[model samples]
Target chain A: MLDFLSEFPSLGRRDLSALRQWIDEGFRTFSRAYGEQLEAFFNPLLRFLVWFQDLLTDAPWPLVILAIAALTWFGARSWKITGGTIVAFLLIGIFDMWEDTMATLAMISVATVLCIAIGIPLGILMARWDRAQSVITPILDVMQTIPSFVYLIPVVMLLGIGKVPGLLAVCIYAIPPIVRLTNLGIRLVDREVMEAAEAFGASYRQKLWGVQIPLALPNIFAGVNQTIMMALSMVVIASMIGVQGLGVPVLRAISNQYLALGLMNGLAIVALAIIFDRVSQTYGKRLQAYRETGRD
Target chain B: MTEEEPKVRIKSLYKIFGDTPKVALSHVQAGMSKSELLEQKGHVLGLRDINLDIPGRKIQVIMGLSGSGKSTLIRHLNRLIEPTSGEIWVDGEDVLAMNDKALRDLRRFRMSMVFQKFGLLPHRTVQENVEYGLGIQDVDQGEAAERAKKWIDRVGLAGFEGHYPGQLSGGMQQRVGLARALATDAEILLMDEAFSALDPLIRTDMQTILLELQEELHKTIIFITHDLDEALRIGDRIAILRDGEIIQASDPQDILMNPADAYITDFIKDVNRAKVVRMRSIMGPAAPAQGAPVAVSDTIEEALQKLHAAPDGCCPVMAGDEIRGTVGIDAAIQALKAPAAAGAHYS
Candidate 1:
């Protein structure tokens, strides 16, 4: 019986080599035809990202540290958080990696902002239309489940390996969580509240802005936090494509077997992650607490 | 009372829920039961042919248990739930045919709703929640704020304007809901189980507050409730629904005294009729009687109390001091013989 089953040529003996070759050839031709146009479409955004990164890195280290610490204070509303943020930034500076840290922050900021700007509307559309959700879901699933490095390959092939390709890879890797969470957030809005809004004659725009978005804020903020963390995690991988950041030190240390340098830079990355996490988590918790207990 | 025109008229309204309700509607109209429709075609008969004329400047209460389509009927007034086939007229304008802009205008300018769940926006203060309808109407912010404050105070939430709905008790949150609806000053108010979420005592207090407000405002109010007592207390006219069909619709006394069918009869079997039936129902032909007359509007309970001190155990049933008829001990005793009134506590 086993021999008979194995004798079916298309079963165990079947090979996917031909299908793989066709897919590879098709992708290569498609990219050769449309790659330039795609890059042209994204050029302005890439330029803006580069300009923003340069502006931040060129700013005085003390001023940048002061501003970040102040922003953390504003969001977290905690002296402890503000102090921690200052200490974290100062540690990066002490390790002679202040510029690299700023570069990484710039990359994460640009990627996170773009992700939110693009992801939230798509998510809202998904929430509003079943068709859009169905169409986008499988795409999001693929984007999230694939190895993060896989994103860099096509991006590099199309844009040809630089800060732009690296940033694009980071964005592709980080966007799905925000989109999924945003859709979930909007869908989770209280049905009674939406009915009340509709009953009160709220227009589509009014309902979206006044009711759904306000209630979805905590969840959306959580998504942003996750996106930022994901973007940061991609820093070292992004360095493989020549985007200069704190990850460069780590990569250099790996090849040179320099333990102290790798450990210091790695700790700096962790510090940045902790600072971003605490600030965003605190802000999200405040919103949730207000919803639960009427205290803000 | 003055004879008011109908503010909201629903003509032959039907709502069927499914992928294709128009196909299922024929079976429903041909007397298929709700369960039969659900079982046979996978379509839920949300409402059967419902016809009603809600009078202007009066409270029209639609009462039923859950799944009776009372809430669905109220939603149809605002066109929140589109009917499978029907016509709804609000203020003599065809609401069903209004375009989106006109419908929005109708909602913003003509009607406001109070919800059973309060539905206060959690992110906003009580004051902001009250200001919502005005904001949607594009009222000037200052004027909107002034009006919102007035209604907030009128609903007896003067100092809690800054508090959120989460900070308030159920009754207090409903007051905020009341304030929000009233702040819009929409001529027609749709209250869907507005007090059903409150405790019994709080619900009674809310009913009193509504009646008092209605006395002064005289806004056209369509209220939905499952509680019979609340319906009787607040409704000038009542419509009772069962399984998506109207069993009977009449004044409180008519409903209590002569139920239209067995279902309605069983419904009123537990009701205290003395408090609902008026002196006019049991009064005899006009005749010379002993003591000060009791008003025709007085409940039978009041007439009995008035007869207690009457010299001849008789009194005139007076409408504004014009004697309509006389009520003696015989008629009073007969009225008291109502099945549920004999030993039931008035409260």
Candidate 2:
């Protein structure tokens, strides 16, 4: 593949060596920086996360299982989803990956929260300003296309290794969809609504928070939903940094040729994605419904 | 004319669109017409030296064709689009000089607008949409809700409190739009062809609603429309605008009877004089005491109704129960038969 790529008329040897050198330099820099600064504080962040993970264990397996079942029941507005939710978790328990699954869930929850925090405001800004949109759109395009493995280097330099850095990497990889979708949602709000707000003596701020943001919620939620799925996909790549969970099992399995372990971990990921996806999509639809009916 | 001064005043208002507006407009003022201004430079003078004085509580309608600057004129009242060179005073306050706070305060407290496309907040319920203006001023939730409910009820949207705009028909949405503006209690209402977007039947319904509201409140209104029928129906004082100038402004009766210019005459030509024109104005001599006579105040619709019920299409249009002139069977028949037949001889 490398030889085929190099055969391109524009290709050159110096470019390849320079790329190799850059990759080598980035890895060493990250290794040194992360070990020195993150070795202590990173441990506590992980412990705090793991402590939060332990708090979930306090709910008891049956209650936790029932909550998931309840979610799917109310969420899809269908009993079929409720049955599927129960079965998916059953598969995780059968595979003996419940604890690791919970850890992955905690990391995902945190990253998803961060994505919403960052993405919605960016989307709002982009919607309101043409110059801001012109500046942000190309960058978002690059962020979405850049591979998950490629992001770990800079994230490790900026925040360094372990839970925080891994989480940051996941955020970078996942947040673009939310921002783009949010911008799309807000831009799609009818021109009349904005004009109405203005004519009603609404300040710009009032129009934004009161009209634009609420109207754009469904699109933002879809973006958030996609972001969660992206974050989950990045979880395995993030684990290659000193982060751990179901991703660790998958990484270990991949390295040691443990097919059963890899297969089981991958199945756990699929289950988790389904569970989160159905729930998020259900809420997104609910918001659209509420917007239509003007109900709470 | 009133003992109290006019509520709104504009003097020599000109809105020129260009980077070098002053330069472009200066050339035009030096004896060049608007077309010449556009030709000499890439400058289009949207509004040119318009002067108007709107009396308090008057429903003054500005009628014009599309691209004739009626929309632009209405927008200027609220500073939605600032005039290029002009002064507008609202309630003795210099509108052009107001800071952002003052302008916004004026909008929230004293003025509001109804756009043609309802412009309802799609994400809000009809009730919440009405509450939006109050919310902008940070009114308490209870007060806003109460006011919104009152206005919504007034506009006859009481049961539709929770319905979004998409669920409502074009006319219903316009009712919500009118309610939203009225809820603000702004003394001046600027309507930019407020009912123009609806079907003819629905448009009539909205115009009826507007008439009822005006009867009750009598807020100073600035209405813009291209439809002359609508313009005549609602305007207490009609201002015929042509290419940014008010060609004729007078009581509707006066304008219908005697238009100010040849352009205005041409515009009013199709407006059946028999319908809007009084028999007293069109008829010259009183009828001898033998033939039937139509009433002086009889609208052409009523005259036609009478004619339709009579043995022949003719109805002697009477003034004050006295025969002014015999509108012979031939005349009524001609009016009924062809569009061109009526009003030409009268004019």
Among the numbered candidates, top TM-score falls to 1
Badly placed stretches (over 4 Å) of model 2 are: A1-48, A57-59, A70-77, A290-296, B1-3, B31-40, B279-347
The fnat scores of all predictions, in order, read 0.64, 0.43
User: Residues A1-68, candidate 2, lDDT per residue (tens digit)?
Assistant: 89878877664789988998898898777767666565565667666776877766566878888977
Candidate 2's residue-wise lDDT over B175-239, tens digit each? 99898889888999989899999999999999999999999999999999999989888888888
Model 2 chain B: weakest 10-residue lDDT segment is B337-346
TM-score of chain A of each: 0.90, 0.81
Q: In model 1, which residue pairs have backbone atoms overlapping below 3 Å?
A: none
Judge candidate 1 at residue B97 and give its lDDT: 90
Local distance difference test, candidate 1: 0.88
Q: Considering summed lDDT, which 10 consecutive residues are worst modelled in model 1 chain B? A: B338-347
lDDT tens digits, residue span B53-169, model 1: 888888999999999999999999998999999889987899989999999999998999999998889889999999999999999999999999999999899999888889889
For all candidates in order, the CA lDDT equals: 0.88, 0.81
